[model samples]
Target: MKRRPRRSVPALLTALVLLAGCVLVTVVTVQLILGERPWISYDAVAATLHDLHWTDLLPAVAGGVLALLGLVLLLAAVLPGAATVLPLDGLFDSGAARGGYRSTLRAAAAGVDGVSAARVKLRTRRVKVRVETSRTQPDGLTDAVRAAVTDRLDRIGPATRPAVAVRVRAPRRTS
Candidate 1:
């Protein structure tokens, strides 16, 4: 299915933070220039900031956490947004097809011997496949599923090849 990516959400969040920062800076600048006591008393804020001591574990930790959050926000703002959907080679039109490959991976895993059913979760950098079977011998089922999934992924040719992990569940009762 074709769907638009939500890259703007983070950008919007970053913009809101920047806007808030600009408002703060403008208020502070105005306060300094015009000598006005406004919404938040700058004097009290300055006193609290200057009095922050290393010995005060709570405040120190809080400051550190806030700094870390700011750093994360900065990185997110600078970094390119993640690709939401994996693009596939188009059959009829260029850039018309996109896939997460969940069904393809699941089918590939289920095709392996002793894999009665399979569940696949495909992500940008990782593919997780889980298989269930009633067969007693599951010695090589894991390796088999892994190989099948890897082969299928190679054929699909995603921009970044994801690591494949295969998990086999216990055999079900034959009743």
Candidate 2:
């Protein structure tokens, strides 16, 4: 079935850039504090971080966590409809046919319009597909990923719809 185009993400790159900047700043701040040099300056401060040890590592770990959170938030905010988060074991957890089916679905998704990359994975009973698209809108990308995945799975044979979860991600090349 033909689909109607929805709003496109003209400002996605801008939003992502901002998100990245935020993450960078946050991470730097936390890391510098952990390093015993919280201030940003031309001259390096007396950072006797050798004594910081595990406590210092907390910020590094937290920075990683915060950065991950930032990226995840950015992705969800920027591409909500296109990306679906599912447990890693959802799709192919059952057996080979299901695993293979998901692979085929991923390949088909990769071939769809606006899709730059496709990753299909099965976790338990869920089929999660992460699709990288040139287009940024989550809704539009989700629709495309959904349709493509559904069509591909249907073509595979008379089986269930297979919990088709979708995620639309901006192409890494653009970032």
Candidate 3:
């Protein structure tokens, strides 16, 4: 039940920046082709660059800020996200299912004979079921819980068949 991670914000920002740059370049090129002076004057730009000081704190700060922004975007794009919802298949309309399947599997395990309570964790590739038993041996309880879980899974017909693991624990007797 793990959904794929995504970094949509960084991608969107990059697309917007590229689009703005393209539009600016296209506008400047069109103005030059029509023999009209664009807003940008090369002489003024060259003069500004010539007078720029290498020790300017503003440019250094701006470069540092840009570098930090790039690092953040890179991390956003690279980091893996925690996903709990998964898309279910094998139906006419695709739909998303969350992790509530654990409850259903737990109930199925609890229904087994000699099981008092059950806990289930359903993952993308595996299903883990734990049961508390007072009268049943751990080995027999594990087998029973595993069979019930298997039957439940077969009935539900999930898109993917993950391996199932069952554990039985003896409940502590009250003094």
Candidate 4:
């Protein structure tokens, strides 16, 4: 089973723009039918459009801007976002499970000796663990963190196990 895709921001913005345009047109039409002055003067707009030329700088700039906006919206709608859930061996998957998996891996890395702080990044094919320690000689810290994280990943039993990479950083000493 695949995770549900998240809503696109550009798609939402496009909907809002269309809704606002429809509301504006409806209000103008109702005002015109009631013989009341509309918010926007149609006659003036018509006159301006009639007098405007395609070669004019303003029209060219406006057309270019609109084209660019359309292209951006189209790309945003067509692009797929990053995966949100980690697939398991069976047909079971939930947000809670993903969170638990991440936390478990992070805890395992942080539990290693000489690791003062641990940060884990879970990707589709690789898990990166960054550990910070105050020890001057952090020789075996990276291997320890990697082994611990790998062990946890094995226990979790994800459908596709990601490779684990560990990096140990020690705080710089000040003179």
> Scored by Cα lDDT, where does model 2 land?
0.63
Query: Where in model 3 is the C-alpha error above 4 Å?
Result: 1-83, 171-175
Task: In candidate 4, list every pair of residues with a backbone clash.
Answer: none
* Clash number for each model: 0, 13, 0, 0
lDDT of 3 by residue, 1-175 (tens): 4475577778999999999989988887888889999767667878987888868987788889999999998888777764555545575544344456677788899999888888888666899898888873455778888989999887666667879998888855555
Compared with the true structure, all predictions reach lDDT values of 0.76, 0.63, 0.78, 0.83
Supply candidate 3's per-residue lDDT for 93: 42
Candidate 4 global TM-score:
0.84
Each prediction's RMSD over C-alphas, in Å, is 6.2, 17.5, 8.6, 2.5
**Which predicted model would earn the best lDDT?**
4
- Lowest lDDT block of 10, candidate 4: 90-99
Model 1: residues with Cα > 4 Å off, grouped in runs: 1-9, 18-39, 46-63, 77-99, 111-117, 121-128, 139-165, 172-175
Deviation from native of the Cα of residue 88 in model 4, angstroms: 1.3
Using TM-score as the measure, name the better of candidate 3 and candidate 4. Answer: 4
Error of 3 at 84 (Å): 4.0
Which sequence of candidate numbers ranks them by TM-score, best first? 4, 3, 1, 2
